[model samples]
Target: MRGIVMAAPGDVRVEEREDPKILKPTDAIIRLTATCICGSDLWPYRGVERVNHTPMGHEYVGIVEEIGDEVTTLKVGDFVVGSFVISDNTCEICQSGYQSRCVHGEFVSQTIGTQAEKARIPYADGALVATPAHPDPELIPSLLAASDVLGTGWFAAVAAEAGPASNPHPDFAPRMRPVDYAARPLPSRSFDGAHSAGSLGVAVRRGARGGGGPGASGGSSGGGLR
Candidate 1:
């Protein structure tokens, strides 16, 4: 299958790669029909990290082609959407809807991300959500958003809302003193809510592109996980 590869910072390219094969007991290979770029992917592309030639995508919608013996709730030809964070969605954090911080979670390899013809998903029973059969193509982008960006951002927002930073103190940023872990986390929530919310704005923009009215362009009512 072909995928986007980043050999170094500012060196992203679409290239052919070896087809993925199962390497673990909990893996499921799926043939992706749709996938996308996440802003997080831009980090390494911008050289914030020393990343190279890793898989390039996380969000994916595909049909399962194979499964491991340990895998359940998934079978061949099953249409599915997977989370960017490799979560089993069964652990304590996952049960509380924190799949991104799963006890046994994993990240998709940078070189073999979701932007391909097929992908091998680990923790198949937990990492992916099955959708209705033959889903509408129009819903693809929305569903893809849920797989990673939406879920991760929501997790961040929820975390910030708890403890010293509740909704009541929405603007009450914590003072940054030495060891001020509390406030540090909340500001990151800025990215959390903003990133999640930013996409909704994009959806609204999509609506505007569809010729929706002025208020219809990339705002509260426009873009969000379908």
Candidate 2:
């Protein structure tokens, strides 16, 4: 398979590597159909984050090609979406709706980055949400966004206490994407700099109700923590 790998700061290359396989009972091997280089990948690309070598990418939407013996709920050809953090999803943290802090959490980039032909995903039963069917081509981008940025944005909105009564009208820079309202600049606000494009959606949902205006900002990273 070929994948984007950062050899060093400011250097990225698409190189050949061995394919991934199920290594554990809970693992599943996926043939990537779509993937994206997250905004965080720019950290290393721009030489801000120090690294000698690193696999790139995290957000992924793929078709399951194989599953471990213990895997259930998903089968070959299942199209799935998952968070950047692989988790058992049954842990205390996961039970509390904080899968990112799952006791058995693992960063996707730490093992099999998603920017490739294939990837081995751990906790398949708990980590991935399969789509009902092969999605419409037009919905692919939205589905892919749900895997990371969109999910992050939703979480951020919830954490920021954005509700129906909250107004999220922050003046954004001219170049900011309108759909990405969460990435806008705010006047005076302190928030965890972590969330996706979905944050603005949540804010809009809440703003439909009434009350204080909510403010959202995209995080430094796309999927996982910065």
Candidate 3:
């Protein structure tokens, strides 16, 4: 398989690599239908983060080419969408909807580059969600977006206290007051609103590029089994 490799800052190349294989009983090998770069990938690319000849990319949508014996929820040829962070799904953190912080976690980008023909997905049953059927070509973009950016943005909004009940009333204008400014809010002030959003658009635009994006485009991919 071939994947994006960062040999050095501003040096991204499509190079051949060893094919991904199932090394664990819970692992699954996916043949990517679509994979994208994340904004986080740019950090290493821009020399902001230190790395050497590392694999890049994370957001992906793929077909299950193979699965370990212990993978129960998915099968060969299944079209799947997995969280950026792989989790056992049954872990305490995962049960509570915080799979990214699972007791045992691994960074997907550090493990393998998703911007290739195939990838090895750990904790297959817990990490991946299959579509009801093979998706239409048009839906591929939406499904691929759900792999990371959209999901991350939703969590960011929730973490920022933008709950479901918070709806934007027309004629609302955003302003930064002394109190609001002094509060030292999270994410950013511009994104905290009823109808306002940021991370999703930014991440989507970043992911749409050949290289993920231009900041810390890497992070922990998923939680591990106990």
Give the Cα error of residue 155 in candidate 1, in Å: 2.2
Q: Is candidate 1 or candidate 3 better by lDDT?
A: 3
Worst 10 residues of 3 by lDDT: 192-201
lDDT of 1 by residue, 2-111 (tens): 88888888998889988888888789999998888877777887888778677688777889999998998878888887766576656665544444456776666453
Q: After superposition, how far is residue 105 of candidate 1 from its true place, in Å?
A: 1.6
lDDT by residue (1-226, candidate 2, tens digit) is 9987888988878899788877898999998889987777777678877766687777888999999999987899998876677767566555555566567777676467888888888988766777778888888888777766665766555443344555444433344444544443243444323333222222222333342333322111112232
- The TM-score between candidate 3 and the true structure equals 0.73
Q: Least lDDT summed over 10 consecutive residues: which range in candidate 2?
A: 215-224
User: What's the C-alpha lDDT at position 89 in model 3?
Assistant: 54
Error of 2 at 99 (Å): 0.7
**Better model by TM-score: candidate 1 vs candidate 3:** 3
> How well does candidate 3 score on lDDT at residue 28?
96
lDDT tens digits, residue span 83-112, model 3: 676667566665455566655545567777
Clashes of each: 12, 10, 12
lDDT of 3: 0.65
